[model samples]
Target chain A: MELSQAARLDQAAEVLPAALRRRVLALPAAERARIEELRLRGGRPMFLLGPEGETPLPGTEITAQTLETVLEMASRSSVHTVLDQVRNGFVTIPGGHRLGLCGTAVMDGKTLVNLRGISSLCLRVARQFPGLASEVLPKLWQDGRLESTLILSPPGAGKTTLLRDLIRCLASGLGCPPLRVGLADERGEVAAMAGGVPMLDVGQRCDVMDGCPKAVGMAALLRGMDPQVLAVDEITAPEDVQAMLQAAGCGVRLLATAHGETLADLDRRPLYRSLMADGLFDRLVLIQQTDAGRRYTVTDGEGRPC
Target chain B: MLKLLGGLLIMAGALWCGVSAVERLRRRVRVLEDLRASLVWLSEELTFRRSPLPKLLEQLARERSGPVELFYREALAGLSQDPEGGLQQSWRRAMVLQLDFLREEERQVLVEVGKTLGRYDAGAQAQVLAQAARRLETIRAQAGEEARGLGRVYTALSLAAGAALVLMLL
Candidate 1:
């Protein structure tokens, strides 16, 4: 049956298996648009379609009430368990759409007990922006060895998208002995796997462990996987800092990302604090979106002229 | 005339009881509503940049004034004391203590989240969060229903007490 966009979205919502449904419904308008766009680009089905401030679900506004409902539910569940639910929370109804979450935390000292009052949510529609990585891969590798690099950008700046493409490029071996790549996709953002298999083709040479902690995963890769380079995303935690240091000590090149609009943003984070104190990373790559399109600049750890 | 005077006194006592009951119910509702509202704010803070999860949780633990505040306190206590033991252990222990207060699915989700965080890999962590989110939809739907049910019960009880007061006056 040919489904209309709204119908497709409705069907997707209906099949979202309960947990994902709430997250999707709670997404802000802008985030929903992004998800729709990604889904269309990826040729995946879109589970949600409607104008801003008007969705099918009642009381599903991107307000405190809805946010509280979502968080309360999350708090009752485990972080890992809820993340998995978020992964499966959508169906490729027609435009390959997906939803993501952002929220407040209830902390006990340094531990996150529960996430409450979810505020912003992004619904990225998954699209396979193929050939995007080809341009960047050549610049990232030299003499067949991967460089220790850091990808920087603000949220929705295509950092994960770029990383995903890079993983695929490395995994394909680009006509060389396949690079054994270990992707520590902490948020399932890079690989987007379903049922233990990658929904996206990250490449045959890649080994993924879905829902594992980044620090532990890096250590494991170094000890067991024997990869030439280790890649992870969005490193912020102190433990993550410790893990990355351990990886660098083992001589494994590293690639990662942090939330920042510019180099200055990088300086304020604990991750940056470690980077300066430890000098662990070799190159810092800055990605920016200008009218000319996506631009890239590679600099040394100090942000000095390369 | 004496009998009528006694009847009037009894009616006044019943009226007082009715008003007090209504006030009590209203207060409880307000407390629950406030808790719900605070939870929403806390959720938003967690996702905001420049604010890490641990810091936010600690703030909430210190400032919260409800039953959930204890959960926050335990989490903060666990995290600050053992910064090296790993965040998952503290979260699990604190969350488990309040597991009985949560819905069954929520309890299961928390348990799984703790386990997932213990592993090594971003993909795994993402998957765990995704799964927990899925279950959360169900839990939210059910919670909404539960909240509504409680509201209805309060209303009914208030109405019944008011009616009893009126009968006593008659």
Candidate 2:
């Protein structure tokens, strides 16, 4: 079984200093479950970010040593191994929790070489809801094959969450026939792969290529894994679009997400507009943050609401 | 006859003491040499494979024996025992507890290396290890020279003292 939210919180807290871990664990169960991120700045009190807002834990100020310990523990006592990710501004720990770092940058001729003397860290907790896309899944298939669907939302609107669930459902054959899914998990977010095995449940039929650029990973997954569907998260680069177009040419279904609120919002951007113009996506799932919860709306490739 | 036997026993005891002292010196040199060799191996593994510390230590313990192997095993154990203390503390504690035969300066060189083992990039770690190995090499050479010179002196002194004592008794 998947770990409970409290257990995930504990796992994320394992990287924290002992005293701070205790303080975080001491929160009420209600507050613990609602925590979305853990923020720590050297010389400042620790803060817990949730849907309500930031809640500071009194009497728990961060130190430089605390940040060092967190980095050491998160990297499994090997910061050098994850130095590339650290240079990129975040490090994804086991279980897919990402630590966004703020620190002194070591640059070499306009290129970021390393991150040193870390001052603040924002640990974004990764959560999975297995059946989140069940209602939206039926509309995404035509005949026996799944449509090449694009998940659209602004940041923090649960785009990755829905995409993850959709991959799990499709790969596990929860509502449709089992499909072989090759996930180009560029940031290690989708599968949270650790030691050649996924830390999170990405279904039995999923093969993940993690911690590589999405463009390279997608092309590799297409050529090597021979997957029925190629899934990637947060399409942001031109190379990613070219790779998707190449994969589409091979008759492989594609599943991807982009940063936008609506179809019109995506069309405004030249990159996304080119993707839409190529007719690469067969359907779009627009996610909106409603007062009660998230709302997922499905539409055809031409922006006709389904 | 009794007098002769007593003289022989004194001579034998003196010889044993000399041998033991020489052996202790040789052992110190051997320990230093072994530690240097192990550092070279560590440097190669870290530089080429970028292997993590725990796995590298486990491999090291398996390949070595005596104080060098014990040192690595103790370091690995310390990691599991009190992880919050981190690798440096564990490494320093391991050296202090297990490698008592080493001189303070020799151990300090290793402690310096431990401080950076898991903290930096492979290139940096390899550079530190290389520096440590070079330092250990210089120490080992001096130790070897000391052992050869001091061993001969200890043996000659023990033999001369034994002979003088026997003559006086007679």
Candidate 3:
């Protein structure tokens, strides 16, 4: 089945507490499909955020008991299985749906040992959009060599959505040769690999390493998969950039996304200074989505608009 | 002819009582053994497969029979359907309503494990299960000894009581 068709929002609703499950079911099918997230906090009203905005779910108040049950169900009655994800404040279930959690942090001398008394929960829907990266593909290919690209966007601007398609199309010979694409999905969001299988279609040539740090995953991809192109989402750490540089030096193309509006955002960061000074990115793409519509702008590494 | 018939009738009744007493003892022992074996399987399932409670229980319910199967089926139904109550409460209810083989104390051990079953990570849950499995082994041993002792005593007593009653009647 097509990955987009297979990534169902109902997967999240199915694991919800029974009382809220009814409310989720009551939502119109189209609205349900458009939901970006479902947030529930103990003693607070449940809310669903979509393209338009937040809609408070009436008569659906999250209770402590209910929140505990949701965590139990999401973790499959075994907290150890999802302990690493839990420590990171989110757990990825089957079908690539992620449940964000916040609770009393059990700390052992500054390191978070685990979570207890969990009270806040958010279920983010991971989805795929076919052909969403068409506008940027041409800009990335020049002289028969695909340029390493970096996607830029603010929160809720569809950067991950666009990047997912970019990885899919590029992996399937959309622009250059059908190269081996290695995805370092730290949060399992890009490829949504569940049980070592991509829930979303990332093309036939894509190999994914999920649930690891971007830096570690990038290195593993370089050494293990020997991929020609490596993709990672949300590169925020120094280690991630170092790995990207190392992989690029090895002749592996890099695709990375970050929380930013433009190249100016990267220039402001001390961590990405050397990366920008090196002219590492061949093509820079900025995505903006507002009430008007979604727009994609392509630029060169020197910040000149294409 | 009438006295002879009466004596034979008494002897037949005594033998039946002896056999019936032995059967109940054997059933109790068999139930304890089944419970221990099922618990061993449960530990293996948790250690190796790490399936969720409902799925694991469903699998066991399908493959097994007798008292252990009943417990798994009841626990599965309660867990899948009970949203109002915690799994511990559901487990207790299922034990009370469905499983008849276990003593109240032995059943309490299973219920106690349910209290932490889904509340923590897999490693912790597996640890709890392994302890419960060990406890189950101990219970099974005790039950075996009890059955061996009780089976012989009850059978002999029942037969002797029947025979003495027949003599008094004569």
Among these predictions, the greatest TM-score belongs to 2
Ranking by TM-score: 2, 3, 1
DockQ of each: 0.02, 0.65, 0.39
Q: Roughly what TM-score does model 1 have, to 2 decimal places?
A: 0.48
Kindly list the per-residue Cα lDDT of model 3 for residues A123-207, writing each as its tens digit: 8887778888877888887788788888889976887888889988888987557878999998887787766678787887999
Candidate by candidate, in order, the iRMS in Å equals 12.5, 1.3, 2.8
Give the per-residue lDDT digits (tens) of candidate 1, residues A1-306.
Answer: 223333333433432324446566566645543333212111122234332222343333344543433332222222333434343332121222344554566576986554444554444544445567676666666676677878888765677777777777777876345687888866566676655777666787887754567888887777888877788988878888888888888888787887787778766876677675688776777788777667877777777645
Task: DockQ winner between 1 and 2, please give it.
Answer: 2
Order the candidates by lDDT, highest first — what do you get?
Answer: 2, 3, 1
User: lDDT: which is higher, 1 or 2?
Assistant: 2
Worst lDDT window (10 residues) for model 3 chain A?
A1-10
lDDT of 1: 0.58
Cα error of candidate 1 at position A121, Å: 3.6
Q: Provide the lowest-lDDT 10-residue window in model 1 chain A.
A: A37-46
| Residue range with the least summed lDDT across 10 consecutive positions in model 2 chain B | B78-87
Kindly report which residue stretches of model 1 are placed more than 4 angstroms away from their true locations once superposed. Answer: A1-80, A83-112, A115-120, A175-177, A302-306, B1-170
Model 1: how far is B17 from its true place, Å? 57
True contacts kept of 3: 0.49
lDDT of each: 0.58, 0.89, 0.80
C-alpha RMSD by candidate, in order: 18.0, 2.6, 3.5
lDDT of 1 by residue, B27-113 (tens): 444434444444455444433432334656667777776655776678767856653344567777787774345545566766676
Error of 1 at A66 (Å): 6.7
